[model samples]
Target: MPHDAKAAKAGTRPGGRSARVRTDVVTATLAELTEKGYDQLTVEAICHRAGVHKATVYRRWGGVDGLIADALALSADQPWPIPDTGNVDEDIQLLAREVYTTFTDPDLRTTPTALIGAALRSDLGAAALSAFFTARHQQAAEVVTRAVERGQLPADVDPVELVRAATAPLYHRLFITGEPLDERAAHRAAAAALLAARAGLFDAPAP
Candidate 1:
């Protein structure tokens, strides 16, 4: 594919030559990262897979870290499904269960799991990972916000905090301790986060 210098240089967002290039590059990045892992990943490989010149990748993304960061940024910008089951507990449980399922399911696990693990290996990737989680937590906090409005959770509850609490343990086990995750663990994480929120442990401090 011929690189549209103008479009690539213009750095357009979503729906143009630039977007197409981005999608192709990021997709290639993920595939490369998944197959080769971060340690063995190379810019030449990514560019070859993406069918773009090495100059384009370097100019736009700087290097491998930039590609990793941008890939995560793109993922964060994408829409995520936040559950709404008309019950706070169920919504929270569903959120935790979704995380568990995504990371553990064989067909679903390879790309995302590899992507996240790769993000942890470098500074730029780590920063992007933090921003990615921040975006996700803020988006998922809608569940707690709606629950509070429905009198299901404390009015002062910190929605992001509650959402983070519910999902942190699963991530910790998956990434930090390398322990096995199960359905019961998912349920427990959700329950514990909810219990803490109800007890005002996640309440926002007064200004």
Candidate 2:
């Protein structure tokens, strides 16, 4: 496909050719990272995948770290809405199901899984991964906050902790046991997390 068509398929957010090029490059960067990992990632490969010249990448990013960092930012910018159904149970269910859908998405899951794997091994990868998840968890934490506002959850419930609790099981299935991540699993995760949170399992301890 042509470069413009590739950029369009990559998902253009805004701006002109520069923005589209950056998007394409970042999309390519994530694809390469997911497929080949950080150790084997190269600008040449990413450029080839993106259908852009190597000079464009070199001129803009300077190196692999820069490219990965920008790609991580772009990944973070990708849309993932926080659930707000006004009821805690439903909210938690929405959160988990969204996570399941995202992780099960053939295009999205590999990117994040690869980034998470890279986080454990490389400093740059760790920074990128941390920034991405920190933002994501922070956004998801708002669901618990909204639940608290509605008296659906305890005032002292830790939002991020609740979010973490709700999502951990899905990651466990994805990375560890390799079991099926079905809708049933999503509902179970949300229910268990909300139950635990309601029981004060996620409440902060006395200092």
Q: Work out the TM-score per prediction.
A: 0.92, 0.76
The runs of at least 3 residues in candidate 1 whose Cα sits more than 4 Å from the true structure, single-residue gaps closed, are: 1-14
RMSD of each: 4.0, 4.7
Output the TM-score of candidate 1: 0.92
Top TM-score prediction, candidate number: 1
Q: How accurate is candidate 2 locally (lDDT)?
A: 0.83
Cα lDDT for residue 32, model 1?
97
Per-residue lDDT of candidate 1, residues 1-207 (tens digit): 346765565655458777889999999999999999999999999999999999999999999999999999999999889999999999999999999999999999988898899899889999999999999999999999999999999899999999999999999999999999999999999999999999999999998
Candidate 2 lDDT, 94-154, residue by residue in tens: 8898889888888768887776665556567568777888888888898888888888899
